[model samples]
Target chain A: MSTLPLISCRGLKKIYPLSGVEVHALRGVDLDIERGEMVAIMGPSGSGKSTLMNIIGCMDLQTQGSYYFDGVNTSDLDARELAALRNKKLGFVFQRYNLLPRASALYNVEIPLFYSGMYGEEVKNRALAALSRFGIDELADNLPNQLSGGQQQRVAIARAVVNDPLVVLADEPTGALDTTNSLEVMNILQKMHIEQGVTIIIITHEPEIAGFCPRKLIMRDGKIISNEISSSDVRSKEV
Target chain B: MSVRFRVLSSFSIDALKANKMRSFLTMLGVIIGVAAVILMMSIGQGAQQQVLSRINSLGSNLLTVMPGAAGQFVRSGNVNTLTLKDAQAIAKLTGVARVAPTVRGNTLATCGNKTWTTEISGTTQEIADISSLEVELGRFFSETDVAGISSVAVIGQTVYENLFDAGVDPVGSEIRLSGISFKVIGLLKSLGASSGGPDRDDTIYIPVTTAQIRLLGKTDQSVNQIQVQVQDLNQMGTVQDEITSLLRKRHRLSDQADDDFNIRNITQLQTAAQNVTGILTLFLAGVAMISLIVGGIGIMNIMLVSVTERTREIGLRMAVGANKQDILNQFLYEAILLSLTGSFFGIVFGIAGSKIFSHFAKWSTAISIQAVVLSVAFALIVGVFFGYYPARRASRLNPAEALSFE
Candidate 1:
């Protein structure tokens, strides 16, 4: 087994100009996530949890920092390299599901594979398999609008994991769902981490949802305030 | 890795299909622009064709020697400047094939009880050959008729129709021109009315000597114009220069003076007509291109709006691993597809429009394959030119900010 962590960040800083004033979304943060670890980040609005997710997803670059993913320094990579890294190694689930409204559920799942330059029948079969893994293969042809909130979230999850990425980042993945739907979504993420040995990170304010993960990190004002490992009973009981 | 052409196209097609009405409206401008270009080109070419055929029919190798300086308007009293002797001199030139001097006068003709006013042209038998005029009923007046000054005439189709009943045989009949009775020896074939020109079939032909003595009351052998046919088309310029110097010498004009007669080359007139029509066609095409540009602007406008409306989708795609180039290609393909499809229907509409126009306007129109190809090429250029800006804007969008955009 590789001793190097899947994700390693040190002194990460992101300063953006908003209306001519410098706003520090992420100020000097450090973190490490090992392979096959399931963690949850809890924070209020403007606490930089979303900023951290964006950086980890390879969708943005830190103004000042070094990010190492899979033993490669991400700070030295260009935009195209970052995009390739994102396509091959990272998966993302949004708060709103963000399934393309006009695309079929199967097509939504095929997007990551398509961007990774895999096409034809193989892409279709793999997308179908991902949908089947989430038990939504019957809804493959249905558009996002035709599916319920929980079903749509399931489709989004299937899309994120379709390429078997090294890490799955869920940013308020169940924010729009009811308590029952939220628990169901968390259950699927937990199942994927345990069964497939996939690393999963969920960002949420709900302690009930965060309880599903083995590790929880709470953030405030652009820094992690608490990092704790909850008892196995809290994680196992939720599943 | 870049997306495949097929995949990009399918993505754009789906996006276009999702908003059917908006896509159609965006294409409407290109359709109208292409149609206008085609229709205008057809009309301009039709006019050129008509002019060329008309001039060709009058004889391509022929020149008209009018009794006035070139580009100067001639009054009716200026008829004495060119005479039959000048026509004889021109006929003797090396490149000249035939010459027919003619005098024209508008006179009333009365046959039986019917009276109609028409133009009377006095010329020799060579006029029939030079003008390519065929006799439908009887032979044209013979050379003997001109030498003897016989009171014989050849009636045109329009004059015959006006002076006598339709069923009547006007040949071997008598018609009075300016109160002078003449025997109708032949009937000229109908040449039909030319656009914006005089009716060619509404005139009468008679022996020049007879007209000079009996009707025109001219003691001298003065004629209005001389028609000359050249043996070869290539010798037109040399022959024209020869005629100019000969007329100047015969008229006793000094070296500094312009010749009293104007030698108009039929080929030069044809070329000038072609140039005019070419400019007209270009002007029309330019106007149509402006509309095409406007259509391109319309595409840019809608694409900008589309980028804005689909910001969240773009963000999502980027998050899922799409780079700037992928996003750029997607939107570019959409714009190109809209223009290409619009141009296709535009070609159909243009062809149909020209056909309908020609049918009702009594004008001829021809749609060239080049015009179709050119419009399509222009549409493609427009698509690429206008689509680039919006696509770049979409591609430059920051994924994180875009994802959070409402």
Candidate 2:
């Protein structure tokens, strides 16, 4: 494929006006992520790792930076264009599993495809296939409330990859899970990366969760302080 | 776009179904408002129809000439201003078809053991044709009876019913009117009570000359009123103008003086009554519209609550790929569906309510297609008007903040 980075950022900064005072959520930062890479952004609460994730997910604009996704400048996109880009190119997973509480797992997986303008039997078949891939096909008709945390996360992952987006952003995907479920979810993410070559980014404050990724970026005070490739054989041990 | 709309509508339906009780409560306002509008309109229309029909029974292209100025109350002593000669002169006009000079007085009539006080109407045979009176049992008095001043009468249905027993033929019978024995020659057909007016069938018809000479003991040939029939409806205004000028000239009235006689067009009275009922209908509909607006406010209130309650869901949908327009459409469709369904039931209840009211109140009621269509259109407008604010609010929500919202 093209020898270009899938996501590139330069001097990204984000500030919020809270009760008449400027709160700096993000400082100038530069980062690059290539295709087929699994990266983790590690930081505690108020460290602005979530802010960076929000910007990278195209849900918010950086105050003073240029963000490029798949070589396209996100700063140049309008609100509608950003939504379209998110729909067609990116997927998201939240710590809460973020599945629609009222909708069945199958319908939740079909949401991205619906926004991408695919409908009818094709949408249904693709959603079913994604659910089966995540081993939740039998629970496709279950609502989010009816499923366990691990099953709900699997449904969320199925939905994130249902449209085969360019990248999947998981912000604290294991934050609300037990250790057994967290490890299982991490293994699934690893298998998705190694087998399907889907780019994955996980944001977490736990070192154990960060250790599951091949590359980890540590953040402090809205600035990325370190970027290192871990030699740990956690993937082989987990898979 | 169509497929997207379908999906959005389905989403709206699901949301509404999730809170069935709340949705129904929100729709209750619209239902009551529409039903009230329809019932009021039907009542107004029914009253107007009853009035027009009663006026129609008096005869088409007909005018009544009273003794005083229009809208002025005339005393019994002033009732003799219109004379038989004036009526004869009116009949000789180009557009005039027939004229019947009449004098009426209430008198007690005795038949066997029954005695009822009824009106005695003195007129010529032309009244039969002008008033469209039918002879149920025998023919009306002939011209020979008028010339001879014979004390023969044609009894109306109400007078006959009151003076005679059930199934008893009053024709060829004798009844004492105001101490004068008169032979009944005919029986007039029954005419139901006129709308809010006196019972027209409670009168006895006799020769005008006989009443003036024998009963009234009047030496003059003056009469109380004159009923004139016109040949054509289009010639009514011309004929009325001609008669006014003729009466003014005959009465020797000056240029500045108002005419002594008052001419009333039956059609004009009908038109004025129709206009009044039309206004009543509009007024009633307006009041009902206020209720509909209140219902719209109820919808807006519920929609606002729904938007707030589903903020997290909206954020999730946006994260999955829903744009602002999609969210707006979903909420708008919900409002529209609520109002439309409410209006449907409103129409049903309105028609049934009107029927029940008319049955119990003994008043006629008419429901028009225009009314139904108007209400449906009005409901749709209300839905859109009230639905817009909440939908826009939901669509404008910030996805990032919304997702993080508790």
Q: What are the lDDT figures for the candidates, one per model?
A: 0.90, 0.89
- Tens-digit lDDT string for candidate 1 (A136-235): 9999999999999999999999999988998999999989999999989998998889899999999998988998988999888888889998775788
Candidate 2: the clashing residue pairs are none
- lDDT by residue (A1-239, candidate 2, tens digit) is 25559989999999998999998999998999998989999977898998999899998888998888898888888778888887887889999988877889999999888888788999999999999997889998989999999999999999888878889999999989999999988888888888888899999988887877889999999999999986747656544
TM-score of 2: 0.84
Model 1 / residue B100 / CA error / Å: 1.8
Which number leads on lDDT? 1
| TM-score of each prediction | 0.84, 0.84
lDDT of 2 at B262: 90
| Residues B1-406 of candidate 1: C-alpha lDDT, one tens digit per residue | 3446778788899999999999999999999989988998888889889888988978999999988777777684465788889988999999999999998888999999999999989998999999889999988998999999999999999999999889888889999999989999899999888777899999999999998888998778899888999999999889999999899999999989877778887788899999999899888888998898999999999999999999999999998898888899999999999999989988999999999999999999979887888888998899999999999999999899899999
